[model samples]
Target: MERLCFGIDIGGTSVKLGLFTENGNLLDKWEIPTRREDSGSHILEDVAATVKKKIADDNLVRENIIGIGIGVPGPVTEDGTVINCVNLGWGIFNVSEETEKLTGFKTRVGNDANVAALGEMWQGGGRGYKNLIMVTLGTGVGGGVILNGEILTGSNGAAGEIGHITVNPSEEDKCNCGRPGCLEQFASATGIVKEAKRLLDKSKEPSKLREIQHLSAKAIFDCAKEGDALANELVEELCRYLALALSHIAHVVDPEAFVIGGGVSKAGTMLTDLTKKFYENNVLFALKNKDFKLAELGNDAGIYGSAKLIIGK
Candidate 1:
């Protein structure tokens, strides 16, 4: 019988599941709504049920399956004990143990962002590089660090929480985390919009951004591409902070590449180009040559990485 595996990424809204062969080819994928009601107690049961159904529907022998790997949206210890997952209303528990008990399969668990990083390293942008950093710029900034081909979960599973790094102490506004001048305050999608609004409010600069009914990080990048001076300034400012943050990360882990992902990265090459320019300018000489690339796996990175976890890839 052929060896098979299941990769599951549990988010607040939904759970993404992928069935793959031992070599990492995704044979099937699907999702189930995350039942956040009742402290998300129904989540693992739903996942186990779905996995069993998939196996039965596919007529796969139970013994042929290797195990299941899960990516949770919170800090997870090396032993798969999730300290807390507010999004899922979950407290400290051994996710792996519970999942195995429910699914009749061995299980492994990891942080979502860290799992995504592993996914990128295994089959996406970070492929071919053993040391890399993945910075996800969505509603907020999230990061994952890989050193010597392994995820750096840190002693407290907070090793890759790059967004909270303070870049400005004098700023009056506080981040969602209640800190001032965090990297997420300037470089994330929401951060870019916030800065744009602040800039517009502070100045009467005539730019296309002011005319848009609703501003977005993508619009800012688009306007910058069109040579709108104000938009360009915002983009430059955003990149400046991001580059500085990456520089700090470079000095620490010295990864061979930085993989940029998330909604804001949809701006494509310009985003990578500008950020690369700024990163190289700010990075030390030894790290100046590090590569920068956009994430390739898109939303599926988490599942891929989850599978990688149990497959030992």
Candidate 2:
């Protein structure tokens, strides 16, 4: 029976590979450095070579493997065409077709953030919920919306870009996406630190952040836990931005839950609690009772979600 699948997550530094059963169980996992020396022209070739080598090493039957699924850091249409992947130095192309030709199996592909959300929905934080949103608060904010157990890859596969939502139109700075006052400018780990630094630069506030040589999201949150007034204010600001974004999303999809992930989510319940507290106040009463859960799979979410593409769980 075709009960196995391959999952690949292509990152700027490395590629995560996993073998999974149809039931969403991870059988084995590994990683390989991404050779981006040639504009990533060799990435798919390398991934195919690695998958074939693994099958040979394990004496696995090709018939038993359902297919392969991959997640890339860019927009991907339903037919598996990647519009652009700057991190990997890739241009527009049909990723699935190329991957299938190389691996001799059916292939599927999706945006990395979107696929990560699918992973959480399948076997991690959003498990048992058919509808939910996955929010990644790392270097930049990213999101994946799952509605009725399927990823909502809107027109042109750019559906769940919640980070780019405009929050502060009056701000002068431009976001990485070339927009002003995006939600990511306030909610992401880097955004939080940047805001903290900006505050320390202009204001003579007696903040512990001013003393730290290298301010990070962790430091800010830790200081908040220790009763630092300035840190608390920053944390509240970050949560407020997140709450506003969540409120907007809730009004649209009304997901059953919101799964928080990425490096900044390390703050744990404090982050979720604060965001939820603000979220409830702004959103309609019907949307206030949604679950706010921490992501359970961590970095493994990508590979798991990739496998889900093949097993369809």
Candidate 3:
């Protein structure tokens, strides 16, 4: 019988699950609402029940299953102990152990961002590259680092926290992490809007961005493409800070490529092109040639990487 595996990506709003063949073909996928009540105690139960139902509905033999792999929204140790998941109302706990007990199958777990990186490396933009860095720029910045074909979890499982890197120590505004001058403060979608507003507040330059009351990063990029000087300046500043952050990372990990993902990545080549130009200009000569590509898997990267964790692909 052909073996199958389960990949689960648990997020704040819902849990994304995928059934995949041993060879990494996605056979089925679905989602369930995350019940955050009671410290998220019902989450694993719900997942296990869904898996059992899926197995029965598909008439699949449980013995042919490899194992379950999960991606959590927080730092997870090598042993599957999640240190804390604020969105899930979870504190430090052995996720694999509990999940195995609930589902009667061996399980492996990883941080969601790291798992997404693995997915990209296995089947997405980072395919063919063993060492890569994935930067997710959404409301905030998130990152994952892969080195020598493995996720760099570090001692505390916080190795890929590129957002918290201090880029402007003099800035008085605090990041969501309660610190000032983080890369997230200037490189994320929210950061772009913030920077645009700041620049507009201080400068007399007129542009289309001044007309939009509900400004977004996409609007700024669009205006930049349409020849808005202020918007172009915002993009330049965004790319400069992002490139500076990546340059620092390049010197440390020296990854072969940087995969840019998240909502902001929808700006497409406009974003990557500018960021790449600045990155090449700022990084060491040896690292200037590193590739910068947008993420290909979209929201499914987490599940793909989660499956790879158990299947060893």
Best by lDDT: 3
Pairs that clash in candidate 1? none
Clashes of each: 0, 0, 0
lDDT string for model 1 (68-177, tens) is 99999999999899988999999889999999999899898999999999999998999999999999999999989988888899876778998988887788999998
Residue 141, model 1: Cα distance from true site in angstroms: 0.9
Instruction: Please list the residue runs of candidate 3 whose C-alpha ends up more than 4 Å from where it truly belongs after superposition.
Output: none
TM per candidate:
0.98, 0.97, 0.98
After TM-score superposition, the amount by which residue 201's alpha carbon in candidate 3 deviates from its true location, in angstroms, is 1.2
Off by over 4 Å in 2: none
TM-score of 1: 0.98
- As a whole number from 0 to 100, the lDDT of residue 97 in candidate 2 is 97
Candidate 3, residue 66: how far the Cα is off, in Å: 0.9
Clashing pairs in 3: none
